[model samples]
Structure formats: structure tokens, C-alpha cells
Target: MEKLYQVALTMVEGVGSIMFRQLINNFGSAENVFKAKTDKLLKTPGVGKQIAEGLKNKNLFAEAEKLLNEVEKQQVKLFFSTDKDYPSRLKSLYDAPSILYYKGKADINSVRTIGIVGTRQATDYGKQITEEIVAQLKPYNICVISGLAYGIDIAAHKAALDNNIPTIGVMASGLDIVYPAQHQKYAEQMLEHGGILSESPLGMKPIRNLFIARNRIIAGLSDIVIVIESAAKGGAMVTAEFANNYHHEVFAVPGSLTNKYSEGCNKLIKDNKANIFTSVNDIIESMNWDTEGKVPEKNTTRNTEIDLSQYTQEEGQVIAFLRTNGETQIDTLSWQTQIPVNRLASLLLNLEFQGIIKALAGKKFGLKL
Candidate 1:
């Protein structure tokens, strides 16, 4: 009955996600919000005359009941913001949805989650990079999250499916609607491995405003956000902004400055809004993912490549520091060498990949000698 009132409260004309949160928090419950008179509702912070008036609509409960029945018939799962299964990351956001509907076996709160987003008009380069990143992240069992839009978002989901990794598509429409329509098959297949999620209730259209709202969930569900490719203005950039605001790690793949599609990513890097993405190893190293116990054991033998002539200037600087200091912590090396921590992580990963430096326990680095 409380859940029904919660659903009905969402139907109030002037109420939105943030407003819903405020109302519930102030009144102590959704039912309480409904029970309170207009004067009482007005006393809540941010609730004005019009919004408080909307709160008095008694007809919304019938609509809520109908939607709840539809959800039940369709076997869709409903999670209120306060539910135990509600995404913890998303709950931290000030404007997170009051209700979420999903269908799938994937856990929204996976141990490691990443969001890959780019422009809808993804270039071939964007598609390829998206696939490559998802493929590489598979071993870590990262949950790939994205908006179920066209281009890069679809590419990320498809790549995760191809790599047998869990991928979630946060929809701009209702759970019953697939926005692009053509990718319904992809949505269906994802349920076998991941899930399609949304805050919109049944019969809701995929409107422009809804997608802008949808982007927040894409950012919220992620521990990190990677902009694979994006133009100067797009939803991908919006998602990146949300991620940065939420204090999640944001990365952008550097591409040629001449390419128009790369402008958003390049700008993000240049503005110091995102770390430069060098490789999947950079993410793993930055996240400090545990490979020792979680992933399958690999061959312990080191295939050392002793050649140092090909190292970049940054790589050389890191190598030189490790050699001089014997064994140094990553933070210490970053401080001594004057490399940003993000860039240092990438450099160390490159050196480790070439067997030039070995990563020790506790993120320390040493020259292989």
C-alpha cells in the first residue's frame, strides 16, 4: 500500500525526482505526503503553491494501480528508490529517480561497473574502440552500462554481449518500449546476461527531455565513465559532465585533433575534466582491480622484453624514476616525476606490459632490471 502511494505520488503533475525526494524526506513517507494538506505540503522546502496543489490529486492512485498491474502482468521488476536492491551509486545522486523498472538477471550493483558513451553518429573509429574497450574489460568481469541509444551506446552493449560480459542498457522510455525499436533483439539478448532498466513507467514515450534525464542513470551506475568518441555537443558529453559532478573517474580516448568526432573527448582531456585513456590496463591499474583472487590464474612466467629504445618520453621518465629509486610507490613516483596520477598509472601499465617494470603489492613499482 505504501509502494502504491509512492507510485501515485510520482503521478502528481508538478512533482519530479528531486521534488519527490524532498517531499518524502520532509513528510517521512509517500503516504504522509498524500495525507498532508496543501498548507502542510507547502511547508516542505522547495514546495510552492502550484506543486503543493498538485500533491492533492486523489485520481493519481487509480493510474498508479493500473501501472502496477501492467508491471505485474509483464513480469517487470519494480524498485523504489529506498529499496534494498536500488543502486547504491545512483542513490548518492541528489536527483536520482524515485522509481526504477527493470527486466533481467543482472545485478544493478555489480562489483565493478563502467559506462561507455559516445555520440549517436559514431564513426567507424568510435565503434572499433568501443568494442576493443569492452572486450578488454571482460576479463575483469566489469558490468558495462550505457544508454540504449544508437551508435556508440549500442556498440558498447553489443561488444559486451560478444565478449560474454554483463551489460546494462538504461532506457529513456518505459520498460515496455525499446526506443530504437530495431535493437529490441539486443535488449532481449541482454536479459540473458545483463538487463534493461528505466525509471519511466509503462506507456511512457521516449521523448527528448526523458533522454536528457536518462543520461544521469548512465553516469550514476558507473564507477567510471569512458567517452569513446563524441562530437562537440552530444549526450555523451552530458553523461561525462554528470559523472564528473558525481565524483566518478572520467576518461576520454585521445584521438586526432583534426577529427570532428573526437572534439568532445579532446576537449574533456584538455580541460582536465577527464583522464587521458591510453588502454584498458590504465583502467585496471587506476581502479586497482584485484586479479589475484577474482580472475582466473594466468601463467606466472614473465616474458621480459628488454628493449627500451621504443619507450615514449613519459614512459622513459617513469622507468628512470623506478631505476633510481629501486622500488617506489605509485604516488611517490608520480610526485617525483611530475606526472599526473592518471597519466602515471597509464605509463606504469605500459611499462609493465613491456616487462620493464613489475607491479608489486600495494601499487609500488620496480624496474625488472
Candidate 2:
């Protein structure tokens, strides 16, 4: 159906995320874009003749159908940008993947998410720090995100599992193919609480460029990214750069001056790109998270009854979404309610004043508990 066309459009030659967005905007759906005439395709912005002709290839649909069938068989969940379950944080980014493949139990859109990245050549100190940070974060019940590489990435995933925290690993390879192969057991174990995700299609191999590209998803999914230990240049640094670009808070754990792995974290601190990560208190305070023993129940039904008729339709729309989805960022609220952010901000402010909702860290709003 429409999902098949969506996968096919992404498979089309030279159809990157930006172009995909432009085409979807112009045609209103991927199905329409594929059905359009070559001349019409050429008329769309940035659609060069080569791309226009590529859309006419009948083989793309067949390939997409084949991939979709395999995806269903593997029990992997596919998320196009427009899908309801697509990660909202990534949706706001201009260059995020238009399609994602996920397999696991954890919600990718968990209310609290953190990214932990570092050099593949992690030292004993680095691994210990990664494990400790994750352990302390258990009470917060946050989803930990990382690229499923060696060193700090694996340490973070293993620690999360030990603490029974939901974690997500963004992989460079297809969901069915676990790179490094050594971590396959950990990857499988993650399925019990966390899961693996990838933008690569069913049979895509993990290439050099894709690994670099995967860092952005790690950055985009997090409210804050922690660089445990990294060299001056590595995938972790690239992830930090993406996190900075996305305006998400970045924290770097300081290390011994002589250690090569500390260079990236030090440079990030020197360049004023990240905060100094000392302990769990830094995260708790920076993110404005409660210091209580356990995270309170969220999105639970309220015992008190309140009439929706008292508010304007737009306000009701916002309230309805929050009631259904729990804490929501302002951007997602705007998208779901079809209200402009500026106007929605005012509505949220009104609701906050009336004690109908409360604002959390990161511009999220939830019904008053």
C-alpha cells in the first residue's frame, strides 16, 4: 500500500532525506510522487532529470516489495518519517533518515533518553565510568541510546541490561546483521528490554559512510549526550558534533591528561561544546530530573474528572494529546495538534497558569500529576 511506495521512494537513486521531504511536501504522499509523470517530477524542486527518470524505473517497486516482505518475515518494524511512531526528536532534524527499521520492546520515543558515546579503544577507566553512569541512572528509568560499536557503546548496553533499563542501539548495518558479530549475544539479550534500530534497508551492508551517518541518530535521539572517553578524532567525536548541531546538551567526562582517549572530551570542554561530567548529580541537575528514589508513574489515568468543554478547541486538542501520550515536547505537540509552535506556546502557557499542565525539562509538557 502506501508503505510500499514509501520504501520504494527511499530506494530511488539520489533520493536523500531532504529531497524526500521536498517530494512528500509537493505530492502530499510517496504514492503520488511515484505515480507522477516524468515531466511533473522534473518540475519539483531539486528533482533533476536523472532523479526524475529514476523514479520511472519499475524495478524499484518490485525491490521495495521484496524488502517489505522480508521485513515482515523478520518481525522488524518499519517507520517512515510520517508514521505515528517515528522518533519525534529525529523528525525535527532536516537530515535525519526518512525510514527506520526497529526490532525490540523498548519505545524509541521514551520520555527520558540519553546518549552515551566514546572511542572504540576504551580504557578500563572509561568502561568503568560508562557502567557507573548507567547504574546511577537506573532510578530515573531513562532509555539509554548508543551506536552499537565496541568499547563504551557495548559497556553502556550491557550495564543497562544489568539494571533492567530499556536501551536502544542504533546500528550502521541492517537490523538483521549485527556488525562485529562478537556482540550478537548482547544484541539478542537487549531484545528483552531494549532493541536495535537502523536506517539501512533489509540487506544493506555496513559501510564506512553509514557508520558516520549512524552517529547522528545517536545524537538526535538523546536529550543529552555523554562522551565517556574518545580520541581527538573518532566516531564519538562525530556524534558529539551532531549533538551540538542539534542543540542537545553534551557532556564529556574528564580524564587523565596523558591518556589519548581523553583528548576528545578535553577538546569538547575547551571549545565550550560540552559540560564537564563529574557524577550523576551533573545530569540530574542539568536535566532538571527529580532526585527521588524512583521515577513516578507517568501517563496514568487520573481519578478526578474534568470537563473538556471549559477550554477552547485548540486547548482541548493539546490536552487530549498530552492525556493520551504523557509528557510531550513542544514541537511534537505542535505537529500533532496542527497548531503553530508560537501559538501553541501561548496555549501551553495558559494551561500552565491554570494548573492544567506542568512544564518539564527540555520544553516538555505533561498533565499536572
Candidate 3:
């Protein structure tokens, strides 16, 4: 029932995602937002009389009920913003969606996630570069995230699949509807290793504004945004802008200035909004990944001299990985070490408590400097 109300809150006219979030934070729940008095709604930041009245409309209850039923019937998981299963990276955004409709399975909190975005009209060069980069990243166990559009987005997804890496396709439309329609096959295949995620409700059309809105999710879900190709203006550039605002790393492949498709990438590089992306090693080194699970011998900081023989093999391996990578995400550590996520999570917490290492934001861990 609470989940139903959460879905309805998104349906309310004039109540945008950010507004719904503020309402929920102030009132404590989506059901409470509907129950809130007009005076109380007025007191809520960003809520005006119009939106307040919309919230009071009884028609929304039936609509939300219908949608909830449909979602359940379709096996689509409905994740409220406050739900434990919601994407943590997205939750950090001020405008994070109040509800998410996802199909398929993925570790949404995968620490080594990278978003590969570019123009819908990808050229041969763009496609080749995307595949090559994804191929190189396969060894590092990176999750490839994209908007699931044509061209570069699909290329990234396919490349990740070919290399056996997990990838996620973010949708501007509802899970039931695939935009461009022809990519449905690709989306279906992605589910084997990744997922299709969206903020839109079932039956919602893939409007232009929604595509632009979905770019934020692509940006938020990634540790870095790499634009392989883009025109002077396109959704890829928009995603890059959102990524920059989110304070995540942004990278762009440089192309000939005369190429119209490369204009966006060149402009981003010229403006210093993104780093000049060249190879997968750039991403690995930039993020300080533990590629081969070897500890950097030179990082003899803090307790480096302490004998790790006292710790369990798992703890010792984790310490060694962190020592090599400087700061590694817990999920990456789990992947590299072949430790189950749940077990690794417990190990990380124990290590943090024991002062052997410290946990960082984005579920990362690093040796105490």
C-alpha cells in the first residue's frame, strides 16, 4: 500500500521528482504526503496550491492501484526512493527519482560502474572505440552502464556482453516499452547479465523530455561518464553535463575538429569539462584499480610494516588489494578476490572496525593513510 502511494505521487500533476522527494522527506512517507493538509502542503518547500490540490485528487489512488497491479503482473520491481534496494548512487542526487521500475538483476551498487554515452548516430569510429575500450575494461570487472539508445549505447552493451561483463541499460520509457523498438532484442539479451531501469511508469511514452531527464540517471549510476562520440548537441553531452555537476569524473574521446559527430567531445575537452579519454588504461589508472590483485610494494604507509600473518587470508588479501589500488570499491574487491558480496561486505565492516582499513564513499575501501 505504501508502495502504491509512492507510485501515485509520481503521477500527480506538477509534482516533479525533486518536489516529491522533499515532500516525502518532510512528511516521512508518500502516503503521508497525500494525507497532508493543504496548509501543511503549503508549508512544504516547493509545494504550491496547484500541486497541493493535485495531491488531494482521489483519482490518483485508482491509477496508482492499476499501475501497481500491472507492475506486479509484469514482474517489474517497484523500488521507492527510500527502499533499501534502490540504487545508492542515484539516491545521492537531489533530483533522484521517487520511484524506479527495473527488470532483470544486477548489483546496482557495483563499485566499478562506468557509463558509456554518445550520440544516437554513432559512426564507425565511435563504435570501434567503444568496443575496444569495453574489451580492455573487461579484465577489471567494470559494469558498463548506458542509456540503451541506438548506436554507441548498444555498442557498449554488446561489447560488455561479448567480454562477459555486466552491463545496465537505462531507459527513458517504461520497461514494457522499448524505444526505437528494434533494440528490444538487445535489451532482452542484456537482462542475462544486466538490467533495464527507468523512472517512468508503465505505458509512459518515450517523450523527448523524458530522454533528457533519464540522462541524469545514466550520469548518477556511474563512477565515470565516457563520451565516445557526440554531435555539437545531443543526449550524450547532456549526460556529461549532469555527470560533471554530480562531481563524477567525465571523459571524452577526441576526434577530428572537422567531424560533426566529434564536436561535442572536442568541445568538452576544450572546455576542460572532461578529460581526454584515450584508452582503457586511462580509466584504470585514473580510478587506481587493482587489475591483477597485486599490492603496490611502494605504499608502505601506516601499518604496512605490521605483520598480516595475524589476519585471516581473506583479510590479508583485502589489505593487499587496497594497498595496491590505493582506494578500491568493495564490490571490485569482492570480484577480484572471488569473495561473495555478502561475505566481503561483512569482512569490510570487520576490517573497518578493526582499524585495518577505512570505508570510503561509494562503498569503497582504502588503507588508512
Candidate 4:
């Protein structure tokens, strides 16, 4: 298994997905391809004289194993596309990666997975909307996937963790490499729940073209993609394009007309490239997904007729506040209800401890019911 993995890594090095597919088909396995002579390698589908010569000179199989060993010492798991645990969504793509490296516990073959992508430079509105979507997807057993860049990517990951949903970070760089540098800690947290995934081998830079290829894997690995915010030309748009091309459902949140970050998403909805989604239910229905087992159980449901005498006035007031507003800021609630911030915090905390309200990002509280 390890040798096949190492062999696939060699053929895919510096090669695009299509070429990698051709090589895999002609060679039967990465092991055989790596051991093949130049002329034999050239007979493989996509292998030109130059590519064959390149393969012959370098001992990439050994190099890949060495680099992967370094990653294993960091406790990362090297995953392959042929592995039984590989995502079925990805397996169906026309040009799936020859291999993928991962960390953490997300079962790639799980029934639910959603890709959340958007602009690298996000505004406050974008961040807020991304947080809401992540929280909504949490109850639906959705595994959030992103490029793990800045802005919306980090926002999506953080919100997923905050809401207790596992998320996957798909990088254009190698598994051992953490691109964007700023997201290393956030990536670590993802490892704690879902995991980090990448098609590129170690020591590879996350250049422009590489990212475009990575985008396809992201789209192909997901059943649906929700674009939060994006510029007219952005990596998020690229992922959406791949999603559409792959016959996966694509949804975008409409943003302000004048906002630069929203143009790409707005255009998608306007052009019918994607459906407009405001809440998790919209996406679930559009994708024709049954999220019955995905959502967290609701316990805060009150018996409208008989629950009046069961709780104190303060607790009742809190419930009413949550039901009416959906999610309220902790400080805002204290101000509106004339309760001290600390006391209000405690009350809300207790409510959550009792499975009444689901906590959203940035101190916002919403009822689970």
C-alpha cells in the first residue's frame, strides 16, 4: 500500500490531474509506472518524451516516501485516492487526484460533505454570513471543505469548530506544508475534528495554476458547494466553476450590489449558475438532501400550552427572547433585559448546557428548538 502511494506521488509530481489519470490507467499502478523504463513509460497515455525523460531521471518514489515520513512524525496520515476511505464524490470525478494526504478523523466516504468557499479578503458582512452558514450546516451533518486560505476559509473553519461540526481544509500545497502561514493553528483545530487534505506533494508551492487544479478536487469531493462571498475573479469563483462542471449543486449567498467581494456570488445567482441560499434549509431543500440524522436534536421545544408553570419568570423571559430573535448577542441581551452581563452570560450558558440554545459565533445565542 505504501509503495503504491509513493509511486502515485511520483507520477503526479508537477503533473496535472488529467495526465496523472492517463499514467495511472496505462501503468496499472504507481509501483509499476515508477519501475517502468522510459520508452515503456512514454507509451502511457499523456506521457510525452519530455515527461518520460523527467520521470526516468528522478527517484520521485523514494523522495515522496521520505517527505511523507516526515509528515507521519508530525502524526499526519497519508491518504490515497484509491483507498477505501476515499470520498465517493471525488472518486466519481473525471480527473480525481492520484493520491491525497490527510490528518484528523473525517471519513472521506461519509454521506454528507459541503464545500464553503469565498473571497480571501472578506468584509464584516461576509464574515457574519459565513459564520451563520457554518452554524446552520453543523446541525445537518455537513462536513465543511475550504482551501484554508485567509478570510472566508478561516471563518468557515472557526465557525464549524465553534458549532461542534467537523471541517476539512483542502490545501493546494502538500500535507506537510501549511500554506498562508497564518492558518496553522486553525488547521490544527481542524485536525482535531475533521482533517487537512492536499493533492500536492511536499515542497511544492501553492502557485496560481496549482490552486486551480486543487479547486476541482474540492468541488468533486463535495456533494454541494456554498459560496459565501467572492470577487468577480477569485479562487472561490474557481471552485464554483469546478462544482458546476462536476454536476454538483452550487449555491451562493447574494451580497450587496456595490460590494466588490459579492460580485462573483451575485453573478452566479443572477446567471442561474447557482441558487441563492439564505439558510441551511434552503440549501438542504435545493440539494434534495434529507438532513434528519445530520441535525442535532432539539430539546428546547416548549409545550406552548402547559410549560408556563414549569420555569421561573427569568428563564421564561430568556426563552422568549431567544425564540423571537433567533440568535441574540450576549451583551445585547443583557442590555435589553436589564440583566448584568455576567449574570446573563451565566443564564445563557446554563441554557446551552441544558441543550436549549445553540451558540453562534461572536457571542450570539440562538435556540436549538
Number of colliding residue pairs in each model: 0, 0, 1, 1
The TM-scores of all predictions, comma-separated, are 0.79, 0.84, 0.81, 0.73
Candidate 4 residue 155 Cα shift, in angstroms, is 0.8
Mark the 10 consecutive residues where model 4 has the least summed lDDT. Answer: 295-304
Report how far residue 148 has shifted in candidate 1, in Å: 1.5
Where is model 1 more than 4 Å wrong at Cα? Answer: 292-369
Q: Write the per-residue lDDT of candidate 2 for residues 145-198, one digit (tens) a residue.
A: 998789999999999999999999999999888987999998998887999999
Leading candidate by TM-score: 2
Q: Give all candidates' CA lDDT scores.
A: 0.84, 0.89, 0.85, 0.74
TM-score winner, 3 or 4: 3
Predict model 2's lDDT versus the native: 0.89
- Tell me the lDDT of model 3 at 253: 99
Kindly provide the TM-score of model 2 when superposed on the true structure, using C-alpha atoms: 0.84
Mark the regions of model 2 whose C-alpha exceeds 4 Å error after superposition. Answer: 293-369
- Please provide, for model 3 over 205-270, each residue's C-alpha lDDT reduced to its tens digit, 9 standing for 90 to 100: 899999988999999889989999999899999999998877678999999989999999999999
Clashing pairs in 1: none
Q: Would you give me the overall lDDT of model 3?
A: 0.85
lDDT of 1: 0.84
**Residue lDDT tens for model 4, 1-369:** 545444444555465655665665677766666678887776666667777766664566566567757766877665555556666566555577766777788777655778889888899988998898888666567788888888988898888889878888888887667888888888888887888888776667788888888888788877788898999988899899988776667889998999998899999999999988878788767644466644333334453443535656777787777665555555546545767666877888887897776776424577775
Q: What's the candidate order when arranged by decreasing lDDT?
A: 2, 3, 1, 4
lDDT of 1 by residue, 1-369 (tens): 998999998888878888888788888899989899888777777888887777777778888899999999988998887777777677657678999999998888887789999988889989999999998777787899998889999999999999989999999999788989999999999999999999999889899989988998998888889999888889999999998876677899998889988999999999998989998877887766666417423323332343446777878777666655565556557656778778888878887897788876434677775
